[model samples]
Target: MAVALPGVVEELLSEMAAAVRESARIPDEHLLSLKFIFGASAVQALDLVDRHSVTLISSPSGRRAYQVLGSSGKTYTCLASCHYCSCPAFAFSVLRKSDSLLCKHLLAIYLSQVMGTCQELSVSDKQLTDILLMEKKQEAS
Candidate 1:
């Protein structure tokens, strides 16, 4: 899955990522910048990060997936490489009306990845495929 941030947002996020990667703390300016750009979405994403709801699942062959436990208690799978998330917000906001760039799940995943706070789980390739398939099935229903 790929991230769907606009070009300016993407560049800013990259800069924030670099700063966090080195300092292990989010710079206030960057945080403020995100808030200025994203409003409540940014705050919700920070809350998700605080909840530690983001997980990175990797297989032996390097296949990966991002799982986000929403406040609603349902797990959403995010394809960070493809910018896909099995969540209604992404479907409705990003793909349908184009009202937003991406959902909070995607933002949470990106921020957690940069902050090095995402929980990681290793599995076999088969297991990875199974997990992804289950998420997709849920989406269909």
Candidate 2:
């Protein structure tokens, strides 16, 4: 069965997808703390540090939104100005209870940026649509 996503969720997802399709590069500023707050996941995120695997996308016209494609094949969206990531770990573990600033995917983006391993791309609308369609198909199956 196909379930409809809420307006807010859909909006976030769309914004994330757009950002992912138009990403240039990870910024140089430190968006989160440098200390390793999370134990296993933090270490694990470091291991999955590959430029080809992760894509940091943001609008070219000064939009503050960001989306990161992690090595695990999951895309995480965030408003860089607000430091919010639309990931389960961010929603359940980071927000509303904790003071952490990043999930694994966000952390991966940060690491990739710092390590200078990010591959910049300008994705077309068709490509973005195709990627989203692929993800939906994978989820449906």
Candidate 3:
């Protein structure tokens, strides 16, 4: 199989996501594009959105982040602003091997934001810092 160009693939998915957000309509061809590119991750992203497992957390200090609840019941931190996800798939596939653009968790976050399906919550700045720190700690252990 030919090696996938992460930039081109991610750009396509991002455009499709933006189109879905603006149009509020899902075309069959868009779904097909996602399936062809992201494969199982695309299906999983839709499931995460359907399950309302994506959350946008905002702090009083004007910072925003995301949390994606996995099928295993674990919540992963997703920093969409920086395209970061604290998931094993991201670590292995995206960062380590460069085989994929983002993990299912990050994809779910994008889909949730575009479709207005993600939950939202507000918190203090301190809480936001703690949340980020906790993610780092988990990675250490």
For each of the candidates, the C-alpha root-mean-square deviation to the true structure, in angstroms, is 1.8, 11.1, 4.8
What's the true lDDT of residue 1 in model 2? 29
Query: Of the pair 1 and 3, which is ahead by lDDT?
Result: 1
Off by over 4 Å in 3: 1-24
Scored against the true structure, residue 30 in model 1 reaches a CA lDDT of 91
For model 1, residues 4-26, the per-residue Cα lDDT tens digits are 66888888889988998788787
Instruction: Answer with 1 or 2, whichever has the higher lDDT.
Output: 1
Error of 3 at 95 (Å): 0.5
Candidate 1's TM-score: 0.90
lDDT of 3 by residue, 60-134 (tens): 888988999999999999888778889999989989998887799988887776677889999999999999999
TM values, all candidates: 0.90, 0.52, 0.85
After aligning candidate 1 to the native by TM-score, how far in Å is the CA of 91 from where it should be?
0.3
lDDT of 2 at 76: 56
If both were scored by lDDT, which would come out higher, candidate 2 or candidate 3?
A: 3
Clashes of 2: 2
Instruction: List per-prediction Cα lDDT, in the order shown.
Output: 0.88, 0.52, 0.85
lDDT of 3 at 55: 90
lDDT of 2 by residue, 12-105 (tens): 3344344445674322221122332444555555565554445544334433334566556676554444556666688777776675545766
